[model samples]
Target: MSTVLPDQLGHFGRFGGRFMPEALIAPLDELTRAWQEAMADPEFTGEFDRMLREYAGVPSLLYDATRLSEAAGARILLKREDLNHTGAHKVRNALGQALLTKRMGKTRVIAETGAGQHGVATATACAYLDLECVVYMGEVDTERQALNVARMKLLGAEVISVKTGSRTLKDAINDALRDWVASVDKTHYILGTAAGAHPFPAMVRDFVRGIGDEARAQSLELLGRLPDAAVASVGGGSNAIGLFAAFIPDAEVKLYGIEPGGDGFETGRHAATISAGQVGVLHGARSFLLQDEDGQTIESHSISAGLDYPGVGPEHAWLADTGRASYRPITDAEAMEAFRLLSRTEGIIPAIESAHAVAGALDIAKELGPEATILVNLSGRGDKDMDTASKWFGLIDAPEAGRE
Candidate 1:
């Protein structure tokens, strides 16, 4: 790669821009400059690869899911990022960028999180790299994902709760952006999605492409052919893209991006962007967003913290628009059922976000029959969701239970 900066400003084909206050321009310039150099540096390459292999556990296997296939009626496989060190694909991009932050001489990592998986992953990187970590989460998310909150605290991160707006992911991003503008020095915004401003979609995609790269090679080696379809849950859509990108040029593979439908799509309480969305601007990128008729972003509700955001990634928007990929919604109840079934039947407790993908796979499998192969990106594990799961399943007290 040439690693050259584009004079055209921060854009990925009319999707991303640094649309921010004037005072933030200089820091964005500095960030762009440093990232360009870091990409070109041989020292950074060697170190990043070493850390990926030794610490973060790159090259997670693509396994043939015989049981899932048998039950679902299609031959199924999984690119198991859930097996990664921090139990999520988020760590791959987080670690790569945290290393770059060190190279830029920045000592703090800041990010906005919804479900808190990204926050925990970033905090883990800061712990290893000895950098300060700050995460902004919506107050509602902080309450829903308390286990992840404790995980970040255990990893030495400071979490701030934003009570503004609707107390969800969109508000969290706004709050994080505010913090970024204020503390431009010693702080790199460790964005969780492959969206946001320029350099982010492409940059994060490049870093996390390891998942797809590995899956492609591993699938062929194990199955002796390309899978019929690849599926991943899309919140901000990094995992889906990371896995889908490597298979796009294959031509034989069908790609599906599963978004969270908190309820039914017609019910208005969902995050099914491509399925129930419109073109809108959010978090510095133009993507399919859950917005109202007046263009205000609507609050998306999903049982999965990782998939409760209002926007799909910019690249995903392009893919859906261009007809290169398919996007669909899997409802919250369906996802929870899939999560529990996968655990009980196969001992795999997938992250709720990942469970959405599994739920999609089951539906696809029924249509494809037993001969077709489907590869799902198991984006993360579900251990961080024990509390929420217990409550949701009625095994424990609800937040408002016994409130007579």
Candidate 2:
């Protein structure tokens, strides 16, 4: 929780630091210097704030989900990031990084995505800023999140389908890093998560920390105090870290990160990195990774395309080790149940990734009882998940002949 963390070398107690090819060192250093200077400049900060407020929609509502609270047997305060432009919290990071790209005189931006939210957000930012945008997405994720793919394309991004290992989030990152190495001189890799090497985890966290900042102040206004706990679903830990950063200084508030327990952790088919992973390196940073005894990365599974990753952000690894926060697994079944429950009870269909936190809040509510209040980061909306959700719950039926 020390503000000086990540040290001068970009390490979060050994969990985060650059582990990239020699070609990347210069660009990464350039990016780090640019970000540091931007953070210190009011002109840069003012422009970023204006864009967030006028374009991406900041200070998203902290809604009191009365129905959801009643169903969970606790007071549930939902930080509705889902309402932001592009329907996810990824926009904040995308916009901030895009601005930095412009400041650094980079005219092209490249990104990697799972669930396609980040890709769409990056494309959106590029379109707005007149930068050329390219997004790499795993083939598997592209199929499951086709709507988001279309969204990115419509926003003027060139989308490439990665057909490499596992064909998911990790593979998308693998391909994106390859592209960065070749094009670092003119292209900026707007990493979507609070992971990757050095400045990425720290920079992405700073961009999205507004989520926690707004929620914290809103909590004080509504509840007269902080909630008993803050909960969010973790894949690469962007949203979770954003929400957790502000609350870290408040010792009374507990933080929980829900990981994807695809099928179940016992089945060896899940993305529950923090819950069931070992220390390892992946995608240019050391973090908790799902790896074999020989250190080969294992393929991860998840019902939600976004959370299907083999490694977690380094800050999350540090938080888990330090016990300042707790990470738990929520199975696909559990997440889906909460997904449907929220849609019905609160009329808000959350992104499947966010449903993991909703499911965890249900369990936490039971533990803390009805009197305890909980804040949940509803990180994204579910419009892009209609295809998967419809199939999951059998809402789609076989069409009758001539129906079209």
Candidate 3:
């Protein structure tokens, strides 16, 4: 319930801080100042609220999952963020940063994406705001998430395929940072996750906390009391933080942060950062990192692009340390099964990231068994993953690689 910063020296208890080069320090400091100013402005608040309602469709509903509830022997509720404009909740952070860009007199936005969801959201905002947008994505990601790549281009954003180490979201981030440093005068980095340097971790999370705010009011209105638990998947931990903020002080509410357990934790092929990771630093945060014994980060694999990260948000690290919330992992197989179940039973196709939460809720609900109520943050729609899912689930049984 405390709004104060945690961790030592701007860290979520050793999970967050600014650890860039000295050349980047001044610009980051300037950004923090500007961000502080914008956040305090009532005019900015007014515009943001209007945009959330008119553009991104704020107040996404908490819908009852009637069929899943019955089968699981507990009432299921879904915070339908999947219905957002970009088919995911990433838009909330992108739009918030885009607004700050305009307010700060910036003319360009640069970002990095994994599956390109954040890139698409940033491009969508730039199109509306008429700002120059550039997205950096892993060359490998460009091949896998080609539709999103095309979508960004169609929105008049330049897409650069990063070819450096890993050629994935992390590499794209490095490229974006280089570009940002080059264009400091005209550009702002719209970080996609609740992980990153100082203000970004807190700022992005604050923007997304709106999810919890709305869900809290809606859940209370419908149930006449808080649900027994709140559940969401954690990648960079934004959606879970968003959905958990309002319920943090609710002592009776159980908060569960689910991570991707690729082929189950024992197989060593999962991205279960919170569940199986050790304390380490990565991507500007010292959170639960999937790292090797030599202190280098490990490769993380997850069927869900959104949840495929080696490190988690700083806030999640603090939560874990403080024991305020519990985190668990859901295997890719389990999540996919939950995805199919939701589609078949509830007529809803959840994002692969959100399906982790669904998979966790299924496990939890059956145990609660006809007594408690559960709400899961359905953070995104699964249409983006349909191609991958079809192959993964043997729908078409594509070749060894999707390209073949």
Candidate 4:
């Protein structure tokens, strides 16, 4: 509901700042100015709105999972972001950044992605806008999410596999940032999530804030009121922020940010940054990050590649500190269970990242019972995850021919 954040110095209550190299500062400032101008200009905003409606397909569905509702003994509603054009909510920010890249007269756009959804979304926007697109993804991710890699290449994007560090999202970000610094004059770096420096955390959220805006209106129109709780998985916090922004002013609605609790939190193998991390700087922003006592960043682990990063959006840190929103960690087993439950009960195969939210909602639903309502942000479809899901559930092998 409120757009006030990252005040003059880009500090979101000490959680966010321009904590990057000197070479990056000027470009970030330029991006900030361009985004400010775009936000204020009706011509730009009007065109963006039109593009989202006509091309990107905004106003994604909000479906009531009647079976899940009955099973959980509470009304469960799903914010169907999985239905978006790019098969995820990443398109919103991608399109916004692509528009800015065009307006800035940049010849190329670069992005970093972990799960490849953001890279695919960026590639799609670049194709639509005729911009040269380059996406840097971790070597490991490129192998695991081969489907998305091929999708980006099909969209005419050059996908570079970074073989550095842990060979995951963090490495991808490092490579993308290095590339941006070298090519800042003729290129725009489209950071994938709402966790980057300054304008990015705020800008990305503004672009995807429609999730919460529409969900609130839809809930009121269909359910006759707002939901008791709003839940979303927080991998860099874009979708969660988008779904929480419009409800921030509504004190009655509770916001739940679910982080990946790989294996279990006690096993030290989770990406539950806000839940089990300390304040630190990572990938240009000072936020809650998984780190060791020596101040070195710790590699985060999660079955869902999308949530396998150590840092989160700065606004989330602010919200958590202020107690305006609660952060929860959903374990890998819990998320997998929810993934199967949703697929069986609602016939919707949610992205693994989204299943974290479903798991959280199921927990809350059990506690709140029949009268409470929960809204879950089904962030992406599970088509890209079919391989992983099938293997995880041991369904990769065909059934025995004689089995009944």
Q: Which stretches of candidate 1 lie over 4 Å from their true place?
A: 1-14, 396-404
Best by TM-score: 2
List pairs with backbone clashes in candidate 4: none
What are the candidates' C-alpha RMSDs? 2.8, 2.4, 1.9, 2.6
lDDT (10s digit) by residue, model 3, range 151-265: 9999999999999987877788889988887888889999898987787888898888999999999998999999999999998888999998888889799999999998788
Q: For candidate 4, lDDT tens digit of each residue in 17-116? A: 8889999898889999999999999989998998899998899999999999987889999999999998999999999999989999998999999999
**Residue 197 in model 4: lDDT:** 88
Candidates' C-alpha lDDT: 0.85, 0.93, 0.87, 0.93
lDDT tens readout by residue for model 2, 1-404 = 58567876678887999888988988899999999999999999999999999998888999999999999999999999999999999999999999999999999999999999999999999999999999999998888788888888899999999998888888999999999999898999999999999899999999999999999999999999999999999999999999999998888999999999998988999999999999999988999999999999999999888899989999999989998899999999999999999999999999999999999999999999999999999999999877778777878785532211
**Ranking according to TM-score, highest score first:** 2, 4, 3, 1
Q: Lowest summed-lDDT stretch of 10 residues in model 4?
A: 395-404
Please report how far candidate 2 places residue 60 from its true position, in Å: 0.3
Worst 10 residues of 2 by lDDT: 395-404
Query: Residue pairs in steric clash, candidate 1?
Result: none
User: Model 4 Cα RMSD, Å?
Assistant: 2.6
TM-score for candidate 1: 0.94
- TM-scores, one per candidate: 0.94, 0.98, 0.96, 0.97
lDDT of 4: 0.93
In candidate 2, stretches whose alpha carbon ends up further than 4 angstroms from where it belongs are: 399-404
